[model samples]
Target: MRIRRVVLLMAVGAALAGCGADGEPIQPTMSANVGVGTSGTYGGVGVGLRRGGLGVYLGL
Candidate 1:
C-alpha cells in the first residue's frame, strides 16, 4: 500500500511539473542602464518600465 501511494505521488508531481510556463519567464518591471565613452565626451542614462511584451524607455 505504501509503495503504491509513493508511485501515485510521483506521477502527480511529474504531471504538475510538465504544466509549467512554456517559454522564458517574464522580466522585471523596472530597469536602468548607463553608458560612457572612452573620450569622456559621451554619456547617457536610461530608465525603463516593462510589462509582458510591452515597455517604455527614456534616455539622456
Candidate 2:
C-alpha cells in the first residue's frame, strides 16, 4: 500500500510537471527588421509582447 501511494504521487507529480503553474501562454512574440550597410553587411531585428495566454506570430 505504501509503495502504491508513492507511485501514485510520482505519477501525479509527473503529470503536473507538464502543466503551467499560472496558466499562461507558453510563448508569444513577434518581430520584423532588416538592415544593409557597406561591405555587404546585413542584419535583422525583431520585437514581441508576451502578456496574455496566446502566441501571435507574424509573417506566417
Candidate 3:
C-alpha cells in the first residue's frame, strides 16, 4: 500500500510538471505595417514573440 501511494504521488507530480502559466508557448512571430504620404510611403517590419500575456518586438 505504501509503495502504491508513493507511485501514485510520483505519477501526479510528473503530470503536473508539464503545467505552467496559462498562455501560448513562446514562439517567433513577424509583423509589418505600412502607410502612405502625399509624396512618399513608409513601412516597418518586426519580429518577436508573444507569450504569457506579454509581447516583445524588434523593428527596423
Candidate 4:
C-alpha cells in the first residue's frame, strides 16, 4: 500500500511538471477589493477600488 501511494505521488508530480494545460499562460482578473490596512500600515479604513475584469482558466 505504501509503495503504491509513493508511485501514485511520483506520477502526479511528473504530470504536473510536464506540458499540462495547467501550465499554460493565463490572464489576471480584477475585482472589487475593500479592507483595512494593519500592522503599521499608513492606509486607514482602506477604501480601494479595482476595475472588474475576466480571466481564462487553463485546466489540465
lDDT of 1 by residue, 1-60 (tens): 655654565455445445434854333232335556786554333444444676545443
Cα lDDT tens digits for candidate 2, 12-59: 444443454467634434354566777675544332334355433323
Candidates ranked, most accurate by lDDT first: 3, 1, 2, 4
lDDT of all predictions: 0.46, 0.45, 0.58, 0.36
Prediction 1 global C-alpha lDDT: 0.46
Q: Model 4 — which ten-residue stretch has the worst lDDT?
A: 43-52
Residues 1-60, model 3: lDDT tens digits: 655654565454444433433545555565678999998998765555555676665564
Each model's TM-score, in the order given?
0.36, 0.33, 0.44, 0.32
Q: Which digits, one per residue and each the tens of the lDDT, describe model 4 over residues 1-60?
A: 655654565454444435334644332322333455665433212111222342222211
TM-score for candidate 2, residues paired by index: 0.33
Please give the lDDT score at residue 4 for candidate 4: 63
Model 4: runs farther than 4 Å from truth?
A: 20-60
Enumerate residue pairs that collide in model 3. none
